[model samples]
Target: MESIKLHQFVPISGEQKPARVPRRKVNGPATAALLIKMATEILTASPTLRHQTNITLTDLAAAEKVRKALLKTPLQ
Candidate 1:
């Protein structure tokens, strides 16, 4: 009969917390698509929140720039 051996957790020396693994990078178009989907969900869930915030035109313009950049559109 073969016996199974379970691995035990070993804490790293001199470190109180474990190191964080780096996140995998998402490609450009996929990232933009995800952002658009998230925005749609948020807006649909809480339409009134948009009217209550202190988001200025400049902020909006900056966000538009980011959105355009994410969508790979040429800046005007």
Candidate 2:
């Protein structure tokens, strides 16, 4: 199985620490679809982050592409 490097920031006692978070390896089509779904949900739930950039429409369109691609893939 392959792995991706995903860093998460953790705050402890007023200090911000960058930690290397372990993410499940997307070894197959099913895992890819799952990752896409999770990413889309995170983007949708964080409205403030989405609105931070002026190109919210573009961002949303990109996210939509992810969803579409996930739908097209046949999960096993």
Candidate 3:
């Protein structure tokens, strides 16, 4: 599988307020890729955006369970 290049928006103080930063490169199967995407979506959908520092342990545990299950299932 080809590596996926992920980027995040970094706040700047210039004409371009937000700059794209290369976060990481993900090289994995389809299932792993889907899980990563889902986890990112879940974190970004948090209610408290501005003041949120880290995700709750419960949320991380739940995500880990889902990821394990996904790893077992075959990619469609």
Tell me, by TM-score, which candidate is best: 2
Q: Is candidate 1 or candidate 3 better by lDDT?
A: 3
Error of 1 at 15 (Å): 24
lDDT of 2: 0.68
How many collisions per candidate? 0, 0, 0
- Candidate 3, clashing residue pairs? none
lDDT of the structure predicted as candidate 1: 0.63
Query: After superposing candidate 2, which stretches have Cα over 4 Å from the reference?
Result: 1-27, 52-58, 74-76
Measured with C-alpha atoms, the lDDT of residue 27 in candidate 1 is 75
**Candidate 3: deviation at residue 23, Å?**
24
lDDT, candidate 3, equals 0.65
Q: Which runs of model 3 end up more than 4 angstroms from their true locations?
A: 1-54
Estimated TM-score for each candidate: 0.35, 0.37, 0.33
- Worst ten-residue run, lDDT, model 3? 24-33
TM-score of 2: 0.37
* Local error of candidate 2 at residue 30 (angstroms): 2.0
lDDT of 2 by residue, 2-75 (tens): 99989998557756566879996554755666776676677677877667754365676786687678667775
